[model samples]
Target: MEQKQPDVVDIFAVEERPGAVVFALAVCLGALVLLAQMDEQTKWLKGAALLVQPRFWPGLCLAGFAFFALCHFISTWTRHRKSRQYSFLPPDELANWARPTEYALYFMAYVFLVPQLGYLPTTLLALPALVFRLGYRSPSKLMASMLVGLCTVVVFKTLLQVRIPGGRWYEFLPDGLRNLLILYF
Candidate 1:
């Protein structure tokens, strides 16, 4: 006797998902709204209290988009069920959930390190580890990651003159090495 196949819900597919994607989108929009509101809520009492005036326009735009998307998705969710726009993603059971979990852990580590180690070092370190975790054993991957980091430093630090944190970790290095790092970073 043959076993019956389990029914799979492809959340991206119109006929299959039963409107769950709409709910998910709504939730995402809700999150954006909350974040944007928080950004506006924390404006400096003395006007741009940080070293520079951080941009607030992007947050404003996100808030506006979230409001409209919430309205549109809620209203049209049912109507769109008849649509043929199927999502390409496989069912949750077939999806590799472990990857996201691993990445989330990496993200948490990145957050903890950013303040102590800063952006340049954090990014340079994260790239090689991420590439290794993703199972790319080739030396080229490591080289490429380093090259990308170098390009990022040149473009953002040298060309654009963007202010990236030098991080405290670099200070622990010997004088010559630290000076070399500071020159590039």
Candidate 2:
């Protein structure tokens, strides 16, 4: 007899009680600890006094996350009384997920190489690599994407006066490049 295959919904369902309980417990505990730290930093101010405090927003965010995580834990506990084995991702879909790693690595390479290659070269190289890695086979899409990315970077560096890594190469680029960098950055 052939074994029954689990449906996509079943495979991804959070029906494993132990996993849900553990995940929720971890998040709640972490949030509580974070809230305590925030309270310490904010000195537990109340009412109008709390409104003026700098730590108020961070503390509120932590408390909110803790509340939601706890609610999810409780709801999961009630709904899935019995633990069910489930696959997090089916084998068939794994290959598609794996392709993005190449793009991520290329991005990291650009980050590390930016100071050495200067912003323009690093960005120019990273953009094409990323576009190709994402399975864009058409040369037109790749060129258009690269041009758009580069133009956006140049505009920010030049027109907006945003600072980007330029290294020693900044002084040597043509006046047009410098003007573009100054205007965009």
Candidate with top lDDT is 2
Candidate 2, residue 153: Cα displacement in angstroms equals: 2.5
Report the error of model 1 at residue 151, Å.
Answer: 1.9
Model 2: per-residue Cα lDDT at residue 24: 61
Candidate 1 backbone collisions, by pair: 12-87, 13-87
Q: Candidate 1 versus the native: TM-score?
A: 0.48
List the candidates' TM-scores in order: 0.48, 0.54
Stretches of candidate 1 exceeding 4 Å from the true structure? 1-77, 80-105, 118-120, 174-180
True-vs-predicted CA distance for residue 12, candidate 2, Å: 20
> Mind giving the per-residue lDDT tens digits that candidate 1 earns over 22-78?
455757678676775765665543555444434355455566767777766665654
Whole-model lDDT values for every prediction: 0.67, 0.68
Clashes of each: 2, 15
Candidate 1 — worst ten consecutive residues by lDDT sum? 88-97
